[model samples]
Target: MGVKNNIIAAIDIGTTKIVAIMGEIDSDGRLRIIGMEKTVSRGVKRGVIHSIEDTIGAIREVVDRLQAKSNKNISKVYVGIAGQHIRSIKNRQFKYIQNGVGEISKLDVEEILNENFRIPIEVGEQILHVIPQDFVVDKEAGIRNPVGMAGRRLDGNFNIIIGRTASARNIEKCVKEVGLEIEELVLEPLASSLAVLSEEEKEAGVVLVDIGGGTTDITVYFDGILRHTAVIPFGGDIVTRDIKEGCSVLIKQAEALKIQFGEAVADLVDEEKVVTIPSVGGWDPKEISFKTLAQIIQCRMEEIIESVKFQIELTGLHDKIGAGIVLTGGGALLRNLDVLTQRKTGIDVRIGYPDSTSKIILDEALNQPIYATGIGLILNGLNKPIENEKDLGNDKDTGSKMNLFKRFFGAMFDTED
Candidate 1:
């Protein structure tokens, strides 16, 4: 682990659960998951924090679990933020200079980038990210890292992700109530992409589909930058419900079946295989063909992946995906999902599982593809400066992290994955 990486945490507050992950960032920048805890999330729906009290309780339990397990002092956290409120828009910001040939300074670049925060929005909206794609200096385009470059004028192209102010406030309240400060709030999808994707896949163009309980989030990258993001209302819950209705099984039983035996592609199943289902009342177990179960799952997962492809096509980057589609989240755990998605999208598909570089004991459970987002939240946290970093800041100090680009300032992930 890096000398400075004593203990860092990432909290994923999702619709179905609140997850807290503590890891040490080794000097090489790999996250070693040392402590982790997850609790059934309350006060959250559609990825938004709805009930502060319930959310606080859930957050506390998870954090407390992590603290006890790892004996790691936990305070600041890099949080994953999501929900229907999250929105992204591409915009260019311009800054004026007094002289026609004035040298562009770091302050000038900051001013131009900050202009993205000036984008108009509804009363309750706030900018979550100001991602600079490139800079145009005096009409020259495609300049990366404009700092230290001289220019008469400066402009920046950015993808600004914004979300509801009220949602953020409630999230902060819940985190603070649990005795932890929200150090940073990163978009959940962006965080996931960071942890699971590799440099080769990113530059080759790929799409990451994270299918969680309540929603299916899609993040697409081309030309080494995030090109598109979309969220589908359908997810694993949709399939579980379908099984419940189709087989007359309880929701819990349906979910159990999914975990134990579900397959996303029926063709991958043997028609002769049969699985017995529990009786609803006090009766004998019923035998059902495994083909039937696989078929049902394929129907729902196919639709979800197809919808994801539709969104990709909408962006006109469908053909550019050399890395194809990488699937993660709870839905990715379904058997044959990778095969099913590849068939549906006509592109290569692979499972997006967390890179377990940690030595913690709970790595078995958290190493699954389901925990990708939470672990990604931890990886993403590595990019942000720890608030009140022990003696890192100068005398003219404030607790805030340096900037959005601070994590990537050096030895950064050169390309998006």
Candidate 2:
């Protein structure tokens, strides 16, 4: 493969699949998708690495394929992280401006953000992101950017995302084992929002629901600011498992049936229709009604929707969600899912495709919800600002690689809290 430092890469390690994408920023500042590949995820469960070897194998295979297609050597990559252990909390920090220098500088802002990093967290947990929601200068409130303004005290309200330290360490280990360097670790829901959400939708208050294989990731935005994020343990795989057990079918057959014939609403199905499943060995075929399958799917989907509703209610902005909910990810493609979500939540709902951004144009087959995280990862990587080599580690080769990702973790979290 050709060595190209300008090429940026991202790996989305999902429960059902791992997607690797390579792209470069064009003169027009658009991210041009050059190569992308995906493979069935192994050793990953609910977006967390379970077996490092298996996860590394999957990552290596996808990366190799992406490299061959793009003809670019992959040295480092940005990766997405999500799982049941992910949670968010609101935090506040205050920094006193110099007595003589009443004007707040960028250093003051950084100091407030740095203070968030020092907040006490659970013993086994680590802060993954510290997003500034709004800034307050002295007694003046609702300040968006306090820098360049004069104030005696600067207060920052932030949304901090925390996850199990072991989970993150395992992910880093997987990337290292694959002979790749970690650029940054982005939360999966945030990446999905970057892929599918519009500025208008965010400003009007929207909830981005990413229903992947093993978990349903939720991100809430109000007035263009991120307000809340959560992860539900149940996802598409659990629904498939319900089908497998409910229909007495094999796991593979269950997944295929859910994808091909599943409906989110049982009442929408005709009870007269039946799907025949071929039996294993010498056993006879079993006949199952369309109603039965829909009923099974509906039960699980309703549960998931209720969980989403609970999280939305917790935000206390449920009634203010003017843009309602935008659903993406593999499970969002289910038949009548938008309709079901709308009915359950009593809010406007739509299927979110990763096509909102004009920065990248992907293959028609890859323009689906399943590729949202991967596309967002590539977009994030392309937009990441360059950091000084000194800010990276001390080793020359490793420092340069680490520099590519330092800004993402340090500055990306400076997002709307």
Candidate 3:
């Protein structure tokens, strides 16, 4: 129907699956899902691309299917990125307004945020985002928006995200090889939070835990702003690996067992319940007790939960989490996972789903926790203006599209490390 360029598209390149989605913002500003497709992931591990050819093939498969289903030519898309290499740091910037007596304008705010992009970063690392946490103007503190406030001196608190240059370049290469341009590279945790967290929960303080196939992404929010973000190197795949080794089954069987019979708490499983694995390689069939399977999953899951707890402690917001923890992603589907998390962290826990946001119009089939990041990517793209094909290759620093980004969203794009 309508012009294809107006459509918002996103591709979530996860460890176990690659999801491509296209949607349109309806009259009420809700993102209505139009077409979605997923295929088995290849050449990706823990959210990082290892094999260019394989990754390209996977991207092409999903993109082609999405294009065919939607009957639209997908030229550009917003993509999500997360891996162990992703980390965030806090930095403060100060600037003297040129017109000291005038109100703080959007230009002033943009300039202060842009200054963070110039801060010294480790070699081989690039700044991905510079989000303003709060602002202080003329000795007044804790202002979220200062565009119309009058102040001579402006101070800004920022959370800056950084990632390995090679990792980012690899993602860009794969998307480009498939003839798709990345509209923006969003951090996975940030995107998932948008899909699952409500404004009140973020205002009251909450921690978002996204357990995917390869990595567990964490994001903390308080006073409706992002406080910290981190990516742990472990996720559901590790548990599957444990099952494969502990149960003496194939990887596929391990995954099936985990999805069908895995439990996060061994104590909850009945001792009499068991699953039989069909014989492989001319060997006799194997019977795995449900309790034993739960034990294996619990051991590995406990370690991951401990890691998440440790990260929360690092934020020093343990007592401030009014909404406790919200778990999302494919790994969050494990039975009794919420129970295990709440028991371990001594806080309330709930599984997060993409349907939490009224801004997303999703059917029952697309409302699962596994689609959280992919759905969130489409939501994240709504804040960004779609790119014109002619402006795709222009120098990022000098392009008109980048200027639009800076003027509208106050986002940072670093072309050089």
Q: Find the candidate with the highest lDDT and give its number.
A: 3
- Compose the digit string of candidate 2's lDDT tens values, residues 259-347: 99999999999889998988788768999888999999999999999999999999999899999999999999999999999999999
Which parts of model 1 are misplaced by more than 4 Å? Answer: 1-5, 27-30, 97-101, 148-150, 356-365, 386-402, 408-417
> Whole-model Cα lDDT per candidate?
0.76, 0.84, 0.86
For model 2, the stretches where C-alpha displacement exceeds 4 angstroms are 1-4, 387-417
Q: Model 3: runs farther than 4 Å from truth?
A: 1-4, 385-417
On residues 1-74, what C-alpha lDDT tens digit does candidate 1 reach at each position?
A: 21255567878988777888888866666567787788887688778777888998898899888889887778
Q: What range of 10 consecutive residues in model 1 has the weakest lDDT sum?
A: 408-417
Q: Clash pairs of candidate 3?
A: none
Residue 104 CA displacement from its true place in model 1, Å = 3.3
For model 2 the local lDDT of residue 283 reads 69
For lDDT, candidate 1 versus 2, the one ahead is 2
Q: Would you estimate the TM-scores of all the predictions?
A: 0.88, 0.92, 0.92
> TM-score of the candidate numbered 2?
0.92
Which ranking of candidates, highest lDDT first? 3, 2, 1
